[model samples]
Target: MTADGTAPTEEVGGWLDKLGALLRTVGLVVAMGETSLIARNIREPEGATAAGRAMNPGLRQEVVCQPDATGVPWWFWVWQGPTRDAPGELEPLCPAANLEWAAERITRVLAMPEGPP
Candidate 1:
């Protein structure tokens, strides 16, 4: 339970389910992984940095959702770009109270040509 006496697991699952549905509507395929929900085609980098090249020849965009300390789940736009030493970078998007708001925010970000830092 969280500080507010809410079950974090249940809250997280609810939003994840909503996100899964929204992603399907947008034609973005989502797969349930061990820890996070993985979505494809949401990010694609034009060029590869040295760090990116070191890890892989081509970099792809992916959206991931992971639970955090707060009841609200953390959304991430993964592989936005390469960091100084890391092959890829993860940008924290936002934490929303409900799936609708989260889907809107995610859709807006996904529409952008450039991925977040």
Candidate 2:
């Protein structure tokens, strides 16, 4: 990854750029609904709680965004409220079909703006 946090590969960079944009756009939509999408991963904690019994714990990250409040574009809203550990309830920010529709639009938007070769 670059010091600026961008991917090194062109393909990966392109995808990241698009995803970043989508994340921002969707985040706005989510914020407008008075919620946040805590995008994070699930990690198992160390150690055991009982004899011969290991208690694994999961950890996830979260971020808050506001509606019509343009500033932090990476933040999102949780459509499925909160979860036990892994961020939000893995809620679908948008339905699969709707995502497809938005993706198509994103593709067109990105295609319209080409970088230097």
Candidate 3:
């Protein structure tokens, strides 16, 4: 992490590498880590800071950011609900980047046999 709240160059790369390693463990051709949890932190355009950019290097499979609303970047927040709204989603948003508890969860999930898509 950098003093400006952006991620350091190496830090971003490291996170991306860690993400790749986690995905490889799961045998996923394309890893889909969650991001809504991390995206919520940004309120402004500049909020797409390096720290934010590096936070979710993995792909988002279920949710996407609402298009260009509030000037926040598309990378921030997971689009939730059946209508794909910006709010009211559950289960800690992105399973990949929910660093709060994901480290263990990811390890466990990756160890299990691939589930039905």
lDDT (CA) per prediction: 0.59, 0.33, 0.38
List runs of model 1 lying over 4 Å from the truth. Answer: 1-10, 41-61, 67-71, 80-88, 108-117
Candidate 2 stretches greater than 4 Å from native: 1-34, 46-56, 67-117
Evaluated at residue 52, the lDDT of candidate 3 is 65
Per-residue lDDT over 1-117 for candidate 1, one digit per residue giving the tens place of the 0 to 100 score: 466644466655666677878876875667654334665543436565778756653322455565446545676666644556665566776663456666666555455355546
Model 3 pairs whose backbones collide? 7-50, 7-51, 34-94, 36-78, 39-77
RMSD score of candidate 1 (Å): 7.1
Model 2 error, position 66 (Å): 2.4
Candidate 3 runs further than 4 Å off: 31-104, 107-117
Candidate 1 residue 34 C-alpha distance from true site, Å: 3.9
lDDT of 2 by residue, 1-117 (tens): 344543234433343344444645533221112233222222222343554233322222333332222222222323334555554443222222233454444333323122433
Write one digit per residue (lDDT tens) for candidate 3, span 2-112: 444444444444444555455444444433333222211112233346776677443333322222323322223223567755554543323224443443443443332
Model 2 residue 2 CA deviation in Å? 36
lDDT of 2: 0.33
RMSD to native for every prediction? 7.1, 18.1, 15.5
Candidate 1 matches the true fold with a TM-score of 0.49
Ranking of predictions according to lDDT: 1, 3, 2
